[model samples]
Target: MKEYHVTVRRSAPEGGEGYLQEYTVPFPDDEIVSVLNVLEYIYRELDPTLAFFDHAACRQAACGKCMVKVDGAVKLACKEPAHETMLLEPYSTRVVRDLLCES
Candidate 1:
């Protein structure tokens, strides 16, 4: 198994203060996981309070709703690979909470 460091920018709900939180996620060395999978793992297995917008049925990038900033670059979370180390933030907009953007 291999572990990855993921730094996530989180914000409180309804225009509250924001901060950065980091988590170490593990994955099989021979398996590739998407960024969305890592997020789901974090939410399901690590933190239940984490909030973000995702439509699991539409994870193929057909919809533009799952947009987020990964390493300062805007990307569809479902379509990007979960790299060894990642810096994640919500899209530049009014953040509802954590990675959930108001746009």
Candidate 2:
């Protein structure tokens, strides 16, 4: 299996300066990988403390809870295709933590 390099904007919900945290995730080239899947991999296999809006997310791109900035473009994580390298950030300035934001 190959890998995907991801840089995610992380922050404390309490309030403080946010910073980018990089992680390399396992990515199989034979299948389609979504941005949300990357986040799930990080949280499950890499870092459990990572905060993201996968809870109750539609995963079909119907519910927009999983919205984030993928390489500076606002997109639904469930629908956005993951590339080899990606920069993930909160879609809004009011970030809750990591790629999570106030909706």
For every model shown, the clashing-pair count is 0, 0
Give the TM-score of each candidate.
Answer: 0.91, 0.91
lDDT of 1 by residue, 31-97 (tens): 8788888899899999988887789789998988888899999899899999899999998777778
**Poorest lDDT segment (10 consecutive residues) of candidate 2:** 55-64
11-80: candidate 2 lDDT, tens digit per residue? 9557788778999999767879999889999988989999889855369988878889999999999999
lDDT for model 1, please. Answer: 0.88
**lDDT of model 1 at residue 33?**
86
lDDT (0 to 1) per candidate:
0.88, 0.87
Off by over 4 Å in 1: 13-15
